[model samples]
Target: MLSPEADAPLRAAAMTWLTVRSNDGADPLPRHELESFHFEGERVPLIDRQRGIRKPAILEAALSIITVYRAEGTTRPYEDGTGSDGLIRYKWRGLDPDHAENRALRVAMERRLPLIWFVGVAPGWFQPVFPVYVAGEEPQLNQFALAVDEVFGLVEPETHLEAQLRRYVERVTKQRLHQPVFRSTVLRAYTGRCAVCALAHRDLLDAAHIVPDSHERGEASVRNGLALCKLHHSAFDNRYLGVTPDLTVHIRQDILEEQDGPTLLHGLQRRHGQKLMVLPGPRSQYPSKELLEITYRRFLEPA
Candidate 1:
């Protein structure tokens, strides 16, 4: 808990820190960075160590809420889930809606205060989403409705502009909530190595989609992704490099003939016709051949 005068400043400082981190491309912030947040020479934890809801001793509303990730087939402490209406459903701390933690959340809802939601992407990593509001509450269900965008706090959409805004919000919410998890899962499957070049640096690797997300079949599943280094990811995206359904690497003819430096020769041209340097240990985690065929055909087409 912080003094009344310090509370607002601390929250503002946390938000600024989060913005800086995001601008620096630190998605799915690690636990160490979250714990290291300091305001006025004091360490103020943005996340609670044991509780779902975090609030100070003061009578102000809740500061934030979190949803921890449990491994597949394991039991979860809360029944939190996304609603059919496209809003986030956050479960109460206990059955009683008036419990201190729960009440703090409700107060945040009534006051329309923005909050940070640290969604666990992996065991110790989290994706920080900010300025999300507790837009609505359902006492009977012992839960609250969270709006990823402020427009959700407005009345139901009745106009074309409002309808478009609603669609945008839904898309943004889905990306913010799902993208980090997808990256973590894909990277884990490949053991944090680039499948193309066998690079082992997790920070320099990306989960490249075999088929782009805009396509109807481009689901965010491990089977539709490949862990690639930044350089290879760009080449794959630009069609300079293509991987066939049989898992052979192909460099575009123009790229192979280019008179570039060692990077072009050793990094890409040499990998041509070679089998992927790394693959997921689990056979079921392999990239989907059908999707690869589609992507490979697109690569063969004139860009």
Candidate 2:
């Protein structure tokens, strides 16, 4: 087997190869003849004895290091006195190494470390790597390769690739949840109909988050959304209106009792009460009952 130190160059080579393949949408160059692949306008020298060097093991280690750099935004030298050069020179090291970090790294490599690293680096990349299995002759590309491309192309050597990767993942995964995406999902869910009045007018529709975005753990998944018109979403968020745990609409009694309440209540009760905008999909992704309950209780509180 190749010494860990000797593997570093191979790891770098693999990353370069994967990046080239992805950019060109082509198959990776053959492993034994990898030196035929150009990197930075130059061909890397081939190892004299390919049999003695384990390409996958080298790739896995490189992937692990890249992943950690992407996730932690820092380079940590291996604990066994091995330097931060991407090679694990210690042949006697156990598979289940005693080091916590090393163990974590190993786990990440064997069990979709690239996916997790990609999620931290670029969540939109998740869709490509997801379901982990595909129905075709092409082998699934390693998910880490996505982040590796970004790191090699965009990141500074000293910069933590992990932090950048995390930012990318967050950006892509949540892209649809921004004002535009949020609005689109909501509008689509409602089919351009108002949640309150059943008013099927495109111009009047609004997409509203059932749970405020700030409180959400994941990016705005479709289930956490609703389609209301401008007035209802405003009133709903301001606690002037609320949805029941069962998704029924309710106008707050206090709002009805305020000055100008007669006009507001008359409009709301006539248009919205006892009705729900039927969600587009199965209720599983619909606003959670627990979330509705929490919003309802907050609305009912003496403020």
Tell me each candidate's RMSD, in Å, in order: 4.1, 15.0
Q: Count clashing residue pairs per candidate.
A: 0, 14
Superposed by TM-score, candidate 1 places the C-alpha of residue 12 at a distance from the truth, in angstroms, of: 1.1
Ten-residue region with minimum lDDT total, candidate 2: 129-138
- Which TM-score value belongs to model 2? 0.43
lDDT of 2 by residue, 110-149 (tens): 4433321111112111111111110111012211122222
Residues forming the 10-long window of minimal summed lDDT in candidate 1: 154-163
The candidate maximizing TM-score is 1
Cα shift from native, residue 5, model 2 (Å):
43
- Per-prediction TM-score, please? 0.75, 0.43
Q: lDDT of each model, Cα atoms only?
A: 0.80, 0.44
Model 1: per-residue Cα lDDT over 67-118, one tens digit each: 8866544557897776656677899998987798998998888777778888
